[model samples]
Target chain A: MPLLDWARTQWDRALGALAVLIGAILLLVGWMKISDTGFVSEQLPYLASAGLGGVFLLGLGGMLWLSADLRDQWRELRGIRARLDATADLAE
Target chain B: MGILLGMARLHRKAGAAVCAVLGLAIVPLISADAQADATYAAVAEATGTRVILTNQSIPLNVAPQLQGPTASAVQNSLQQSDAYAAFPYPGEEVAGIPGVVGGAAGVPLPAYPFVIATSFGDGAKQLSYPGIELRAESTETLTQSTATGGSTGAGGTSSARVARDGDDVVAKAVTDLDALRIGESLVISGLHAVATASRDSAGKLTRASELSFTRLSAPGFVIGLTNGKFTLQNGTEAPAQNDVPLAQIAAALSGAGYPTTFQVPQETPDGIIGAGLQIQTTLPAPPAGTPGGFSGETPVTYTIGLLRAEVAYTVLPTTPAAADTGVDAGVDAATGVPGAPALPTTDLAGLPGTVPVLAPVAAPVAGIDLASLQASRAAVGSDVGWIYLMVAAVGLAAVGGCAVLYRGAR
Candidate 1:
């Protein structure tokens, strides 16, 4: 499936990736602004705001993506537990 | 199946490492500033060995050379001094008067009783009798191959001073003053010219040639105003204009009628008399058909002025300190130098006065120093509250996103 179509089905993962993309763009723009500046004082603000903010959004997106993965693993484990219980009942 | 999973995990790690390396590489692309662009343009304009700084480990080193108005203005003033130093006195050879440290003296023959100071540069400087005073000062960047060298050194200052004291005429030109070097190569060629003449009250010329020259040498071949001869390669001189002769001054002072007897140097002296005039000889050919007088790369034409004088008068000081005053002051500092005008910081599209390049990956930022950075930061007192605020906001957003993910998974 096209990534966009898959993302529509998996909205959680899509939002996480979108946030990461925005954060990366913000970081790049901030870096561009800092490069044109001469003084550390001039660059510090960009580093703090955009730089830190971008990192923050990245971490958030990673966590959200990780949570979706864990949820998938939990669903798989629950199906296995149900099947094992049904077999136990048949043996009994 | 377990082995396949382990191989897939290794591949993912390798892919992440590659992505990290690519992200780091993007830093250099964002580091281009206006000065770098200007320096790149200048190098592209000049013809010679195309120096490319590819090996980031090996730093390219070049002795900084003066750029902009200060250097050219000083050169112009020195050229005028050469004219005076080369002035032909009937009985005496005007030797040592137009060299590195000697001044160029003697008013042009026609402009008797009234001294005329002629300099071919930007803006016309005129001096009238009975308080004749003329002073010009300018500053220009001592730009190196900034694109390759990756840094520009401090600027140089040049000044021209012309003053008349009774029967005495004094003109001085001092260039490459207060020059500073950034890199290892210390190549500085400074020119000083001072011409002073004293005559007895009786009006008969007593002393006409008073000159001194100072020369500082580095290890390599230096090209500048050497022995009153300016070598021009790949450049052409602008014709001299606005010469105020004694007749014009006499007409202007006709009503005032200051009766003063002035001795005119002989109009025509034996030998070539093109002093005080600059010429542009054809490239790769001997100057005026004389053999072995010029040397420079092809396609780079430098104008040679015949005149040599050393008058030190600062017109506009556009050094970093002076530049901090305002944009107008910095632009106005380009009052000298015909072709080489001062580079105005205002044209950098609202960037900081000096748009120093960020260090490429592992190197220090090319032009900006630690002391200046700290000083600038302390002076500006940048408000970083927005940074903290954004961090907090993002942190809260991440927590909320995490909660939503957990509920969806459940």
Candidate 2:
């Protein structure tokens, strides 16, 4: 049971990290899709600025969603670990 | 598990690859800036070279000039050669043309041999040549013997007349009515011999019918293919190799494995003439690593205004006024008829001595140096090939990403 709880905790952390990375990737792709040929036409200065904004927003959205998953997974892992610990103590 | 490491490397490379591609894009842009002017100049230079090379040839035309002495002399020689049937004038026809008065019965080489005795004479100059005549020729020799008082031999009409002399006929020169000079003897070989017993009303010595024609043929005329040029109607040769500064542009194209045929459009002082070189090729797909049998015909085309440029030519000989005239009447009647004035009696028929030439080449000039322009265009194609490489880099990146995710999961 303890092993099971440990495994769940690891899974939760991994999934949480994955979700953050995936969200970041999705946002990057979405922003790039919207940039269009105009971004290049205006030259590097305008392009660089556009890239900064897009990247920032995408990163924020990604982190925000990942944090939410982390929170939920952490709660579930805590519940599992607590029940497992209590059972272990009673067994002893 | 090692694939995870590879994926990481691959991902990074993919990012770098995109940067590299974007970097390369600047290459064409930069090269274009640096080489555009030079390339076009090269094209023009090459074109000019081609034109000059083709145009500088010494034209070929047979010029004929006989002085008063030579003319009369030739006329006398014709009269003496028993090989020819007599006519009042050298060019007068025996049968006679309805309206045209000049021309005569053909005597094969009898008249053509005059060229040997009187080609270029005093007081004659240039002949506007279609081209020069080829020389694979023959000549005539005089034959006869002096008979003492040959003037009154056996016949009332000049005694030089003999009954028979075995295949050897003689030209008895009648210097005047009473005086006679024996010319050299002419051994008539390979001549068809015919005999006819002439019978008057009683069939007595009405006289052996006498009159024979010898068949004659001369080597056909040949025209050279030296430095052929395609001339356009606008009086300009298309695709001047050196239009600007690029010399050896055509040679360069040849080096690049381009087929020798291409077209170039040219803008002359008058207007634009499209010109181009065309390389015809035959490619056969055979078994792996083997070349197949192939044949090809490659010709370049150049269009300048109304005229086109390409190599062409024709050959022909002057027609004899009569069948025995030894003139080749119909040779290159197709290339286009030349405005030639007929000679009075000789194979030296037309005054131009050249066939009517219409080498209006089929090719029109395309804009400029074709090979060089093509080279630059190829540069563009190469740039595109690089873009495809970038696409490949992206594919590798995607695969790397998948590998990374899989490994991380493990």
lDDT by candidate, in order shown: 0.30, 0.24
Top-lDDT candidate index: 1
Q: Pick the candidate with the highest TM-score.
A: 1
What lDDT, from 0 to 1, does candidate 2 have? Answer: 0.24
Superposed by TM-score, candidate 1 places the C-alpha of residue B276 at a distance from the truth, in angstroms, of 30
TM-score for chain B of each model, two decimals = 0.20, 0.14
**Tens-digit lDDT string for candidate 2 (B1-410):** 35434644543454344335434543443332110100001000001001101111123421111110001111101111111111111122212242233234333222322111111122121111122111111112222111111123211110111111211112121211121111111111111111111111111111111111121111221111111222111222222332221223333333443223322333222112222223212223334443332223222121111111110011112212123322222322343222111111111113242211123221111222333433443443312223323332343344334334434543
Interface RMSD of each: 14.7, 25.9
TM-scores of the candidates are 0.26, 0.16
Give candidate 1's error at residue B71 in angstroms.
31
> After superposing candidate 1, which stretches have Cα over 4 Å from the reference?
A39-45, B1-410
DockQ, in order, for the candidates? 0.07, 0.01
True contacts kept of each: 0.07, 0.00
